[model samples]
Target: MGSGEHDRILDAALAEADTAGLRGKAVTPFLLGRIVELSGGRSLEVNLDLARNNVRVAAEVAIAWAARR
Candidate 1:
């Protein structure tokens, strides 16, 4: 990619980081969508992050449910 393309991508990422909402401590989906768009449609990294976080949250929920049972 040319310097122009790189600069544009960087600019887009910075723009996204600007508007991203903090959900407790992490960036929201809307912002992540912008990032994935800017990242040449590479979303697997984001998917992995979401999946990992989901797994942890699910495990916590399951533990809580078991405790209540």
Candidate 2:
């Protein structure tokens, strides 16, 4: 929720985007792990379905940009 946490999530998401190739379900677990680390071991509540969808879209966009380079 802080800037540092947000940056960490973005970094992880991008990494997962490049490596996982838009598979949201596959990527969600990794994202959740990163979130936990960023949150200092505290459990966080998130809408899994929405998170997966967002990650899928983000990964697709990232892939598209990568393809251009």
Candidate 3:
């Protein structure tokens, strides 16, 4: 899906979660499930991509930091 579609789905899920009074521990799972439903499983793919990117960035940062020691 396009970035705009992803943003729309994520915003809708977040709004629903807010309206439902989801807080703290309840928020993550609720938003994730809602996004999956709204995006027809595309959200999971995006989430995996984001997670991979995060890991990659962290690894790069750690390597840089270690090199500075």
Candidate 4:
């Protein structure tokens, strides 16, 4: 994704987190995981590191086709 697209994706994900009433690491992980999941299938991952806080969060997502609900 380009910088602008990446930014929007992040923004939407953050907004999703806000809607879910979550913040910080929790939100970051869920957002990244969904983005990765949307991008592909079997194996997808996103890593976020907070340099100032020296914390890293990584998520791996896998998707399978769903039969009718």
Q: Largest lDDT belongs to which candidate?
A: 3
TM-score of each model, in listed order: 0.41, 0.36, 0.65, 0.48
Query: What is the lDDT, from 0 to 100, of the residue 69 in candidate 1?
Result: 86
Error of 1 at 9 (Å): 10
- What TM-score, to 2 decimals, does candidate 1 have? 0.41
* Tens-digit lDDT string for candidate 2 (1-69): 567767877687668666867575767677777666656654354445668889999999999999999
lDDT of 3: 0.93
Per-residue lDDT for 1-69 in model 4, tens only?
Answer: 456756766677677778899976787679867666644432232332244233322221112223322
Better of 2 and 4 by TM-score: 4
Error of 4 at 60 (Å): 28
**TM-score between model 3 and native:** 0.65
Clashing pairs in 3: none
The clash count of every prediction, one per candidate, is 0, 0, 0, 0
What RMSD does each model have against the real structure? 8.4, 13.0, 2.7, 15.7
Question: How would the candidate models be sorted by TM-score, starting from the highest?
Answer: 3, 4, 1, 2
Candidate 1 error regions (>4 Å): 1-42
Query: Which window of 10 residues has the lowest lDDT sum in candidate 3?
Result: 39-48
The residue-by-residue lDDT of candidate 3 on 1-69, one tens digit each, is 899998999899999999998899999999889989999998789789999999999999999999999
lDDT of candidate 1 over 1-69, digit per residue (tens): 456765676677666666664354354565556656776665556578889999999999999999998
What's model 2's lDDT at 59?
100
